[model samples]
Target: MILKYSNFEKSAFLTEKKFFLFYGPNFGKIESCITILKSKLNSLDRTLKFLNLFQDDFLRHSFTEIVNQNDQDDIFGNKTSLIFSLSDLRVSSEIIKLITSQDLNIQNIIFKTGPIQKGLKIRKFFEDSPDCLIVPCYEDSLLEKKEVIMRVFENENIEISLDHKNLLASLLSSERLNLLNELNKLIIYIKTTKKNISNALSILIDNNSHDLNNLVYLLASKKRNDFWNEFLKLQQTFSDEIKFINIFSKHLEKILFVKDKILLGLTPLNAMKSLRPPIFFKEEETFLSQIDLWNFQNLRKAIKELHLCQMSILNNEKSSKSRFLTLITKILDL
Candidate 1:
């Protein structure tokens, strides 16, 4: 029942499953796929109808009652899609089971969520069910972003010089949604405004990013104002709290790697320079500055805090962002 997000057309849409749940941190990819799903629904059968029922409206009727009501809506028994809006509050197995167990007449029952935890009952049901298709949409990694940049850059007919392509890709947002949006704006801005396109685009791309990478350096360097400013932008930019903290932990691990290097008698500057992908040129000074601030004790303590913060999120703690920001403060004091 689990389908790769990229294979939705061949593997998922053509299947006879009645339930489709697209859940993850990749909001843009989820929405883009949904648009394709809806279009396929329309073209696959013109007689088919689409109905949207909100969470409040759904509570008034049982799952069976909802299906039966739609069944009776058209005397000809034309197929219809019943997409129910659900939040974190009502994602119970009992309710999900009510729909999956039935031999329903609905064409599709689509559900969308921000990000479902691994062991959540709702995610478990969808993954286990043959009648359901679950597609997880997470942020693209750097490798994937490189491929995306080429594809999007080519498709958008971007006319930037070859030397700037690598720079543009590196500066791009990791989110597929924001990446495309910013690319479009970049193209338009290029057409109308020629001066400082690269500089303007770099600022736009970095600002658009839900950038844990930048925040880590800021916190480790004890730049309080910049750290919180980026934190505020991150909250508004992306809904996936776990991904945010996960990125934070990863950057800490990077610095920890450098600490290990320093222990081997390599100078801090040389240790940082030895990093494989290399720190951003703009961030090299910041990285060098933080090397002096971090030692084994604080590095271990900060990592321990990150582990606890991740646990808080998995436990469904209220304001996981608070836990994340607290970890930043703890690291600052270290």
Candidate 2:
């Protein structure tokens, strides 16, 4: 019922149980797996029929009625097999008891929705059930790295990598399913476009992403106006909660206040001293030196961009879109 294993382990684990509960924080990968399963259902058995548990008049019908439908008899009886796909698990206790207590002998797959913590709780529930085969779906963290995502971008033949940071950021940006869908769309777009491919693909695959606005503000703060402009050009559909403003405001304050008192002129060392360095930066000093070469004049442009970012936060705070921004503004000077 409750077991942890990689995607490769699924085939071997199939013999272990009949009720497969695929629960995880990462729905993107799980969704892909489901899609694959749906496609392969017929291949597994000619008489196999798939049913959407959340579809039709499911709300009106009790779980017992749902499990014992006439259509189900066609699949559940004799050589026929039933594939039950559930996106939600809010079924009544009566329905759950019916399914668990009876020897239904159906292949049930539950798609765990929501955040990782919630999915984990759902997984534990199924783990206690003796008659079900539960597979908690989670991405392999080691395989999902910046390097792997980049490889996918470079070669369409390669599968997209599930980098934890990028996946988490995408999840925070939107729902897990939506983010996964977007990433898939993005990959398709890149493949179709004739534009010169560069390391810009790297930006699309971040390990950690702040709120879109915070990301916009940070790029603007850095005077990477082109990147900021491109980001803002994205449709309103991408607007995530303004949680990053607090973090953005804090970082902006540092950008404005932190100065290299040790060095009078702009230098590689000075730039490193002034700005908060990201974790990846520590691995490469060349990036720091390039930043330092920009001189005070370019840096001032970056600061001006931050001023605009600050204004955006203030506007959001005033509109009550976010109170965090107001608190951030009060703590830091505009």
Candidate 2: give its CA RMSD in angstroms. 11.7
lDDT per residue (tens digit) for residues 208-307 in model 1: 4536567666877888888888777765445445655666677777788988998999988899889988888888887888777878788778778788
TM-score of 1: 0.65
Q: Where does model 1 exceed 4 Å of error?
A: 59-65, 73-77, 89-91, 101-103, 160-163, 195-199, 202-218, 221-226, 234-330
Q: Model 2: clashing residue pairs?
A: 19-133, 165-207
Candidate 1 residue-pair clash tally: 0
Task: Write down the worst ten-residue block by lDDT for model 2.
Answer: 325-334
TM-score of each: 0.65, 0.51
Could you say which candidate leads in lDDT?
Answer: 1
Model 1: how far residue 166 lies from native, Å: 3.8
Candidate 2 residue-wise lDDT, 226-245, digit = tens: 44454465523343433344
